[model samples]
Target: METTKRGKVPLYLWMLLGFAAGLGGGLYVNLTGQVVIPEVMEIIRSVGQIFLRLLFMLVLPLLFSALAVGVAEMGDLKSLGRVGYKTLLFTVMVSAIAVGIGLGMVNVFRPGDGVDPLLAQQLLAQGAEGASAIVGSAPQSIEAGQFFLDMIPSNVVTAASENQILPVMVFALIFGIGMVMAKSRATDQLQETLQGVFEVMMKLINLVIKLAPIAIAALMFNLAAVFGWDLLVRLGAYALVAVGAMAIHMFIVYPLLVWIFGGMNPLKFAAGVKEPFVVAFSTASSNATLPIAIKAAEENLKLPKRISRFVLTVGATANQNGTALFEGVTVLFLAQFFGIELSVGQQLIVMLVCILGGIGTAGVPAGSLPVIALILVMVGVPAEGIGLILGVDRFLDMCRTTLNVTGDLVAATVVSRGETDAVVPVDEPLPAVAPPD
Candidate 1:
């Protein structure tokens, strides 16, 4: 709710300062081998965790309200279907491109070829010790049939309470269709009420977002304190490959999509979405960054409210271009590290699974780790090899999340340009819908 004045410092600059401070402070602690470093990290970790929790607390309400209202406002089920198809198609196309870029880069770099065997062994052992903590008891494998069935929640309230986004999304879509079919005074009032709640949730998110710089500082400081420079040095090659792949996707793939599909200047698109990118990079959670993305699309990009809300809210859960790329490269890298050669056919399967996994994976920090482990096991690579990359995952996560959020905005822009009318100004109120007599 707080507004920045003309003369005062901008929020992104503060976040950048936080990042620099955390990096410098963490390096000092790591280099000095300070006896009190652990204690300091614990305090910072607690504060960072609290900030993360605050952001997550708004996710479900914001998602439900935004998605449900957006769907209902489409005026009919057919329009909603058209938009849904376009959105899904765009998400799949972009995600596949990301995976391809990652696969090519990792293969060319061959980062796993020279890993020290002893270091690999140590990392494997550490992975075994911490695997339970990372995934919280291995998930029971579910049949594909059951997985699809489970996506349709029998009880919407239960799904929402559990933060089961996919199922909650299904419910919202169905509920919105029902609203469209049975339009009445009651439905109109309900739609209005939901819109008000959505706006309130956005306001709450704005307030919570102010804590980002501090939280980012704490998170990065803890990461550096715990992992230190030695781990980074050891994993530097793999880190470079992953970061480079993401850079290519962000700079090349997305810009092209924006220019060709949206017909907008790519640099202007990037500038419009800068605030969300910074938050996504710092927070490393697309869901937490959803409200901010919506704000950017509507306010900065002047996208239609319906298009921005629907695309971005759904994209938060489904369109993880960055995660898909990271997972694909990671699986191949681990296979190489363990001297396991994946046949072309096997690698193709890995690619497919990475694309699907990106959709199912949660949009939070380290959310893809378990999926990466599972994919490794599927491809005959040791699941424990996950530890080899865990050391650098946090840093890569920051980079990839920026791409994920950016991809969402790009998808929204392209889809909106194709399907909607002229862009609406942010300050103007949405037109009222008349209740059926």
Candidate 2:
């Protein structure tokens, strides 16, 4: 529940300081060809690993509690009624498109490729020792039949033990659906318990994130020291691709959905949702921006309150097209960076997980990091490569958060289409209610 700002010094200012120090130090070593002290570099690497291990330690519990609670909270689809189904359908379809756009952009541009060959080899060599176990255990090639079959998991505990993330996720989802069906006092308690677990995990993750400034310094220094200016170029390319993919989804995809499905003019929709867009970008937290989005839907867009509330509220958490797209792009970019080749089936697996991840990922700053890290490990990419992106993530976070909020409003507007309820009148005075004695 803590804002990104903590105490007198904001978390972002600290993060920026860490980024600057690391970048400066790394560039010095790179340009001068002076070797960093071995002991100091080792300490830096250890610090980075500590951070990653902390995240790795909590990944399963976090994933389970978040995904399960998220699904259960949706309530029974039958109970959710017509609007629920429509919102769910729109969320899935639109999130898929967003991921598709990101994957396509990465594959076509291959930004992860075109790095200096020697630099790529050095990165591979550095990561190979730590990554060997994961890389070795990964399937030599993904087969369509086996891939689908393995999703069920012969034993959920065993799947979690082996880091078979997809199977674990499947189990969590089924578990959630089971809670939804039971619908008793015990089930309600179970839901609350899971919700409690999720809140705790979010707190723990945020605490870990507090160390991110140090972690970012270590991570950026490592990359910059070795890769030199090429690191910046590749990082720039990645940020560009991420922003571009999001832009496509926001400007092109959302508008098309609003026009075709919602029967609203695209230009009008864009103008009406501008306030929410700015709020989302500035805050980079969907949950924080929810009130603004609701207001925009009701006031500027003149959407029905009932539909807008339901869709926008759920969309704030469940309908994160932007997060899903970013996850896909980061995974592929890292895979490419590490010289790992994921086949078509594997990429499809990434896309599927991303769609699920979008639903489960916390609506907070840097929330997508845990999911992206796990996906990289799931597919044999080195997890440490996440460091390369963290320094630049705030900007990307802002960009995608805007997309997330905009997507929510668009869903609200689209879902409101043809509802018999009258739109809220702009500038209408509130009806006075008598105070209770």
TM-score for candidate 2, please give it: 0.91
- Could you give candidate 2's per-residue lDDT for residues 1-437 as a string of tens digits? 22553456767778878988888898999999997788998899788778877877777788888778777765445444577767767887899999999999999998888667787678667665655544234443566588888789999998888877788888988898798778788988998998888888888888898988898898888888878888888889999999999999988998899999999999998898888888788878899899988998888889988788888887888888999999999999988876778899889889988988888786645768778877887787777788888878888888888888898888888878888464445689777999999
lDDT of each: 0.70, 0.82
> Model 2, residue 275: displacement in angstroms?
1.2
Looking at model 1, which ten-residue stretch has the lowest summed lDDT?
131-140
Pick the lDDT winner.
2
Flag clash pairs in model 1.
Answer: none
